[model samples]
Target: MKRKVFLSTTFKSLLFLLFSFIYTLLPLQAQQLYQPAEQLGELFEQVQLQSVFPDSKTFPDATPLASPDEILQAYQQQKDQPGFDLRTFVMNNFEMPPQPAADFRSDTSLTVIQHIEQLWPVLTRQPGNDAGSLIPLPNAYVVPGGRFREIYYWDSFFTMLGLQASGETELIQNMVDNFTHLINTTGHIPNGNRTYYLSRSQPPFYALMLRVLAQQKGKEILTNYAPALKKEYDFWMEGANTLNAANPAHRRVVRLPDGSILNRYWDDKPEPRPESYLEDVHLAQESGRNPEELYRHIRAAAESGWDFSSRWFSDANSLGTIHTTDIIPVDLNALLFHTEMTLAQMAEMQGNKAEAKRYEQRAKERQKALLKYAWNEADDFFYDYDFVKGTTTNIPTLAAVFPLYFCMAKRKHASAVAQKIEADFLKPGGVVTTLNRTGQQWDSPNGWAPLQWMTIQALRNYKHTRLADTIARNWTRRNIEVYQATGKLVEKYNVEDLTLEAGGGEYPNQDGFGWTNGVLLKLLTLHPELLQTTEQEAVLQR
Candidate 1:
């Protein structure tokens, strides 16, 4: 029996609009066994769908049948055959689709820096006339390769940092333009520019992206991109406008007992995600939780960009306990704070006095609410606030760095956070993503490029330069070590155990990494004076 929570009709109608946008959730991965429906439109249902598509190695990401016309054709041709094997039929009709090939090989002769510079050009993709699920972007952008072919929301920001280092300002400009285009079209940037990711968004990093551009282009970027930034801010602040003391929370906005508002990760989606179709279905069956609730929570985690991590689980070790929508991530609120402040800055720059004041007040309110709810003085570390549970969670992740990263933390708080990171977060290779190694890609051992950048930046923000340099060095060394060995950079690294490749979550480790190259480039550029030139030369010589 599932417990029901009644919601107001107005809120229900709002979610209905959000849901209508997410229609394409088809099973695309190979090896990932997904039982589909009998037929969705012209497509085969899960039953026949499983038999039709092969494994991940063979079929990847909303593939084998790219269109409704193709699906209709496949069923029409195979319906009469008594022994219709969907896989064989697909092969017969469509050309044997092969994954994109790389031109560069594992060349130990090249320095890791040189190898990365080589891969940057390869990772940078222009979609151009490329059709299908590799959704065409208006601008050229870097992709974290392997399975990913589309531009992601937050990934591009960190990736842009490296592009800046590579003197690729044009690429960064294109990335911002692409995001601006997305905001103009969709009201906010989706997690990635995919039809399936249409229902949700990743971490609200648009403001940060603008900041990166502003670093190069000056204050003009704020006014120039103000409309897109305003659209994004409005998207996150949608329900908050209508919210009042009588009804404080709606959608992403949550009004606490004291009438203070903060945002929570949310997705209007309530189904098995097409990309992770089988996994979502299997988890729903096994978890025994309300399937719709679980789906929403899972989707919310994706919005949080710490997808499938222990931080979202009610029980630290179990995927079944995932309740992502229940907690308010420190990072999400911090990003929103940045967004609000950025909006205010832009408004003031444009001489919009009334709008500037409104945004500034909003930022102040959020900062106060965040400190009240998210800060844990007892632990001397920031923890995600469990809005549903009514306390700070025990789980401590790199999200703690956000306050310092955004300059929200007080000197005392910043001092404590820097110490905490130095003591627990840092590893031999880099900072482990989280203390928990729950076999999720976002969990321990998997040190992602974005988090590494945030952590290093935060350390430097509080004048912990030596510690920041250490982290930057370790993370850069790990990235270089991996590149030297595989002749490639990956989406994430196993910072905890450098000997093993990073593993966990839905897919295999990805290479031609967008953020990896970007962060390395930016870090190297930022601390060129601190370079271990002899050590790097020794590694390359071998």
Candidate 2:
């Protein structure tokens, strides 16, 4: 009996050793299943409690879930009037610019310009205030200071506008070349030149970038970048065509019910998301809320940007907001439609009829799906339809205007939405981001440069020239007014008050802004004719 016991003990020890060796040899991805300790620990406790007392009858009551149809009905009823008090919204949300000067003055005089030119190398320094992070090689320089602002995705789009207007065709081409080079090297474009954004991309602007470059340069440029464009497209559509499906994770492309595929924003690990944490803390401090609740609020905001959005927030979970889990988005799909159209055009030009036909068909199908699922006829706007909840947020925001820009919205529907904008969101200053009373930067009383430009362009596309012109002019006037008063361009503005207090973002109202300044120059130069288009005739006809 003593010998048998000894043998069993020795076998157990050997097994343990084998397991330890196997664990050590595991891949990094398998070994690093690191979830947030707090969240995971809570989940573990719940599992243990259920296992320990199988007969225990403890369940939380179900909260009522709002359907997209219900939200749309409610929004249709309430969207006509000003959704929130304009004055209070502006005052509560606005943040004044920091006191003291950063000295970014432009010198036009020959002597000063010459001196400034000599110092351009130092002045246009890339974001290297910290020695810890690697500085990216400089691309095109933002003039006046020659400072290297890595105009990421949106900044690049807006900067291209200025480059086009200022007759800097070479610079515009260089910007496109940089993006193409990055795509070829990395398989995807980073949000900026920052190492932090290397993991996830911003908007899929590769096709748009190519289209713009092609327009500016010619077919030769498009031909050169076609392979790069195709590679980036493959990156966005990664994991989408997999037959052996697995649980979705960051960077995985998922398909929606409508059969279109797109990627949603995600991070591999969960921490208190820096962007939402800052915004939520600011909001909680302003509203006098408990810090814990603010954390939850921030988590909710972060989850909203995730692939499985409904799973991220309690309020959103019931509506099958889960449909967005690895699902396509209206904006994303619309952008893809543009991509398909561009690709088809390129293929046709290249004498590839087979490829052109395939892309053209794909674009049409996506357009159909986007309109079918995302549009709410009753509300006269587009809201993200949660396929799971059969619900939509009836929130009239700038996202609604994207379809128009893509020429995806029907002429009649686009016209109706434009009228709704005039009746509701548009102010003397420009267009508000959304009608939500939350006072978020993406909410009302805050007007962003990109959204304003988008709205103006969308209206012009629909031949609503007059209203488009008015919006463009009003936005430019407000921008010029603020600049003349403060000698600075801001990231956003208090549209309601024409005040310097710009509100609602992770950072405290970023200035020395790149995109805002770029868009302003573009609108003023390329589309001045849009400002002169009259809406008086359309109103009279109505």
Candidate 3:
């Protein structure tokens, strides 16, 4: 009797062990089976909707989507909501489709499709109007909250291009109008159309903004916006020549000769940078420099958006010549030159030919100095020259391309530089902002919409149609692939893996992104014809 009872107890223990193993394996298998289907279903849902509200905290009282029916019901309810507040509803509930579960290692096509589909919603959203306002349409992508609550300065420029392509001209006009309004209401445009950017401004794009509006709306639009444009121009040139003067405490200060003024990528105070926390730390380590020096370097780099340490600065002797301090950037000067030229053109249009001629002469002089000082023949690229140290950084970066945009670089140099971009910067997805091994957000492995547009435009300007077509086709193909797969558009993509990574900025990459959508559409519409031999010949003649 005792032996039989002991055997029975052992049998029960074995049974219990077997059940536990099965329990663990069941969920893992179930997850594998369920997740992909769920994610695909989500993508289908997104394809059918116009916008979604992903920010729930902003609308805590709204109902949650318990099922597909609930999502549709919410839309109907939103349509009925008073005051045309579709934006509020969409911001509270939008979510991106899950990344495809296929092995990224074996299937490049699957990876490309996944990325494009993920970017779909971002591509479809209307262009103008505040991204976070009470507008009544669903944005095509998901944008994160916190520091991303407002529209960014430079980002808007690219976003506008996408809008133009999507046949959303009215929305683009609205976006331009908002910026003009901000300039009229405030002495300067905010860094973004948000409360956060109110403290400091980014690169002065007011002239560029006006130019874009004029291109879309007609030359006459400039007359109405001239006062606001002048005000913004003055804001950028403020204290430009006042290196020796005492200034208001709140005003940005920079040393002369170097032409360094407080520019973009800085805040009023020394709070940690929200987007580039890792890059900033690495820069400090590689430079073997102090925080104050690094801070100034950060500011200088902000002028060009190429914030990283490279082989150029690896040597201490060369690094010393690098103005990590109050430094001026060649691109900044080039941009200002364009601004001046635009002003001269505007003056000419308004019948102020005498003033136009004066401004034109000033632009030409600046251009001459820019080429003389910024171009490094040894490196075969234009670099940021530190006027104080009287040396140029030898790091080859995207800033080198801007000279071509402004006709600052001669034809020979532009051709050489364009070749460098094709060889080094071009990736499968698009031209990267910079090389990625540097670990900078703006560097390699990261492709941003604005830089892509800039590179395309610059290549066309220099008559490199073959190269331009290659870039435009690659970018558009990638964009469409992602859109078809995920049913949304995104702010940035991971060029290294050819997958979508969270975009960098003060916040998580916001989808329903105004600029990304706008620029993609623009590229789709204009890029195909941009590569004709006639276009290339025209550039050469110019």
Candidate 4:
């Protein structure tokens, strides 16, 4: 009896080993199935639509607790059963996404800068195994906090400013490597390191980040990152050669009537964004425009990193009229100009004269085209070119300062923009994002740290030292005031009215703000006098 039992057990063990070996030999996708969005198709959409979680992003960000195949199989079997609970099924199959910085309480006794230093560790995320929608990075990175639990493309550049001030050189290099890794493995960096964000990217700030790294390490840092930089530039200019008058635009590339090429924000997908699924669906229903066209425009605006702003809207007050892809943004072109010039320098360093010359020519052509098309001679500011209408956009936002930031603005243009800033845009706290009060976070009344830094730096570039100083003083003072009041730095501030918190956006204003911490620390470093102000004085300034 004992021998028969042993033989039966041995036979079962042998079969198990055989099956495991066969499983290993199967195709990778067959063996390990599912990207979160594709795997949980109906479940994903329904969860978002029903508002299973208050934030639409929650379900998409949740991690699978079991093998995707097992989860999917179970879901299919149980979904149509009587008394099926979608929420319970989801909870059983997946781990809910954690609230960002949930239990942390700020120690108000510390100075704001000291508090920022402490918060760095809290905001920093160590890379782990990839699961669900979250794409894994090889190195640890600082997230922008709140719902932004990933390293954002453009946000990282500004965040690095604080990291630099904090003397976190290794951390900065780690971030740059992570971005380069994304370029190497994924072909281009997504808006953030997520499968859902693969369809689009935020503003191209890779070249700017390289410049910062080079400043910290050495000029050779640019040479090392040259290939990744070229890859990014190529990603933006993908269909430039294919574009002609007959097909004026293809993806991000646009060919003007003069046969000059410029870039615009674009998305590969025309569907509602996976994260903001319900919001896009509802907006499209009310938009009256073709759903696909509206979806594309909405996604493109997201790609621009200004999700909903008057700058992208046909009617400043209406979110439904956003037409982002129709306009060639000044800031986007200016950043690309910098990328081209940087590539030229990197090529020259490596003795690739032909590539160097090619990049130089591209940069010059872009500069000329930018001045011709995007520059508003009457307003003396750079505006986005509405290619669909064959005219410059009437909306004048902080993007006008980008030309000056890149040293592409003429002396007259720079002076005019500085005057415009002081006369119209500058506020008690900082410069407002744009002149229009459209109840969009990127519009009037709300000031963001990155824009404040850009405007101040742009003015300083033009030797408008007094204006720069005044702006810096106001901005730093406001930051200090907010910190004293709330014991937390926020994503955006109410620059126009100091008493109220920054408002207007899909979500409430978020704290643990990566860019705010970064820009504030850098500003304080530059203007140490702002640190010495008494609490009463900080309050009185408001």
* Most accurate candidate by TM-score: 4
TM-score of the candidate numbered 3?
0.63
| Candidate 4 residue lDDT tens string, 328-421 | 9999999999999999999999999999999999999999999999888898888999999999997989999999999998999999989999
Error of 1 at 173 (Å): 1.2
lDDT (Cα, 0-100) at 329 in candidate 1? 88
Lowest summed lDDT across 10 adjacent residues in model 1 is found at 30-39
* CA lDDT, every model vs. true structure: 0.76, 0.54, 0.53, 0.86
Backbone clash tally (model 2) = 13
User: Please, what are the lDDT tens digits per residue for candidate 3 over residues 1-542?
Assistant: 01111223234324533443344354322322211112324332332232233332122112233343465466666665668555554445543222222222223233322333344343333434322222111122222212244445666666655544444444455555556555645466665543323445666666776667567557766655556667776776565565543441123434434343322233343422322333344556676867555655454444333434342243422333234333445656777788778878878889999978987887887777777777888867787665445567665667777778777778988988898898988887778765535444555567777767777888889899888778776666665555545644566666656565635432354344445555666765564443243234434756
Each candidate's number of clashing pairs is 12, 13, 47, 0
Where model 3 places Cα greater than 4 Å from the true spot, the runs are: 1-147, 244-325, 496-510, 528-542
What TM-score does prediction 2 earn? 0.66
| Evaluation by TM-score, superior candidate among 3 and 4 | 4
Residue 479 alpha-carbon offset, candidate 1, angstroms: 1.1
Over 458-496, each residue of candidate 2 has an lDDT whose tens digit, in order, gives 898999888887778777777655654555566778888
Q: What is the lDDT of residue 67 in candidate 2?
A: 32
Show model 2 residue runs off by greater than 4 Å.
1-101, 106-138, 141-149, 243-252, 258-263, 272-328, 527-542
